[model samples]
Target: MRTYVVGSGVTKVDRHYERNYLSLINEAVNKALADSGLDISDIEYLVVSSAFTDSILNQVDPSTYIAQNLGFRKTRALTVSSGEVSGAVALDYAHALIRSGKARKVLVVGFEKMSEYPSWIINRVYSKILEHEIEGIKNVSPPEYAAMIMQEYVRRYGVSREDIVKWSIKMHENAVKNPYAQLQFNISLDLLNRALRISEPITMLDSHPIGDGAAALLVTDESITKKMNGALIEVVDIESSVNLPIYLRDDITYFSSTAAAYKKISSKNEIRLDKTVAVNVYDTYDIYGLLIIEALEICGRGEALKCLDEMPYLNIGGGLKARGHPVGATPLYQVHELRELMSGSSWVKYDGEISLAHSMSGPDNNAWLILLRRWV
Candidate 1:
């Protein structure tokens, strides 16, 4: 009934403008199998996560195509897309399959090819996140949505420009160590303060770039882990939720869906922050990571800055910002970072470590959080 991540891998998040979807995934999937000490023969099911493939590569039912090409022709395959949350959702499916005893091992892959199209075209595709009334008609894009939320948060919470810059700087620093990260340039807080603003307080540096890459994870039951001697990161709890829209949420200060997920994770695991060692919350933008701290109940409202001062914060080295937010592959990257951050002589980990990952598609919609723990 319990599922554990046996192995995981991610391709270097970079501009693979020359490569197609299948090619990108081929590298990622092969790395995943090698990491898990398993082969294609051990895979019983495949879950592919991609959203831009239809327009970018003119491909549909990519899961089947990937399965066929990977020599898992007869294995069951499913494709899922939920904007930026596509990767996390695919992971959720893999966990479900393992929990239900329907599959012994599920290979979950999330890939996106955004650089294949022009910026305007990519913006048009991202516009699907909004309603037909506002965004669909006015062409409000993802960056604009993030800008609005960020403006409101700064105004309401009195979060200074320095707070946002710190997050970006940290993520970039972390990316330097993460060879798989797309952007590894480090900018000091002083340099960030001098940069031009994007929309109000939102600067160009506050956002994640359009990246192309793939990430994969091989999830299986605990019994399989024992037999394989693979690295074990137990999934103690996982939950998902959605809110009608940003306006409909109880508060815009933090995502309601994330709050809902936090409650579920706590209730299921009966654990609290005192026991948690770290968190890898979705950080598509600087403000989102700031909002996540409050939403996850790790700190009180407008207390993220204080929390950062005392406790380690999200996106240690340039989270999604520097790491590359390859839409469909962000969640898997988070898991990858979590596993490494908790193992060996890592920067942050304790005797009994518990790490949490939180992600969302748009606003508060299609949210999910996973609680993971290191065994001994």
Candidate 2:
């Protein structure tokens, strides 16, 4: 019965074509209630994270049309569509409505617009979030079922092609210092040999574009963070796993909800995943960001492409492959790119307290993992 994340916000993940979806959910929900100094009447509950739609904005219960266009009278709006981890299922339903006493303040939002259609109509609405009557309605999508499980994990783990283009060139050099990244340029390896393959071994530069924005968080509990302070992050542990659908998984090549968020974040954080300093999963396809570093066992099986030149803060927010996979607002921009890369300076090349954010939905039935730390 605990949770904290005082405040968060994000918006620039491109293709917003001058804002829509209720002004990108009222500019990332009023900059996450103005970064949680708070006062949208101290938000009660709103937890949206629904996605994919845009026939001139068909508002099919978009969290009660963004809580009746933000007037929010008497709060309590919900949505949480579990695909693309509908923003980590609306931040695990606002951390279970503030640990179940039933709200002390919760506002997690996660909208998406997908450039208002036509990329063959949002890739057929991202193939209706898979399991399309037995895997992609018989035409196959989700980048041809993740390019046939990344061409059988690069032919049963012999993986190469410079270890599969080194995680799209290290997530575009971590999205070039991530200004709310939506593909913040930077890519080479000979321009990925003229990419644009689309589904051979997946490319167009390893996918994750056509993104629209909105990400937010407010979460509360430590008695509303002792009457609100600046930068705090807690969410000690949160785990979720639901699999067995891609033609009933037995072993459809890993992703039992990323091995159940790596066995529930290593049994509720005894500490592992190479003593996490940084690692945001759900790479929005660079072959599941190299099978989520061997499904979060942190490397072993197929040795996650030679442990990506020794994992120095992998993903570092350039995850969701250069931070644009705005599906269900991308798990609230993975807690707004790991709370803006672990709130302010701590230089010295490592240890930003602790961090890990994972999210998924459908195909990997529905997965979630979040474990931040840093409060001191």
TM-scores, all models, native as reference: 0.92, 0.35
Model 2 compared with the native: what TM-score? 0.35
User: On a 0 to 100 scale, what is the lDDT of residue 29 in model 1?
Assistant: 86
Tens-place lDDT per residue, model 1, 215-261, is: 88888887788776434687777788887776565667678788888
For residues 1-376, could you state the per-residue lDDT of candidate 2 as single tens digits? 6888877777888887877877877888788888778877678888887666533266665888788877888888868776788787678778877888688888888877887867887887777787667666776677776777777777887776546777888888878777778888788777666888888778877777778888888888888788655567887777877877755666666886778767877876787776245778776778787776677788777778777878777777688778778788887777766776677632214547778888776446677888888776
What's model 2's lDDT at 253?
62
Error of 1 at 49 (Å): 1.0
Residue 160, candidate 1: Cα error in Å is 2.1
TM-score of predicted structure 1: 0.92
Cα miss at 223, model 2 (Å)?
A: 14
- CA lDDT, candidate 1, residue 306: 66
Give candidate 2's error at residue 41 in angstroms.
1.6
Error of 1 at 157 (Å): 2.8
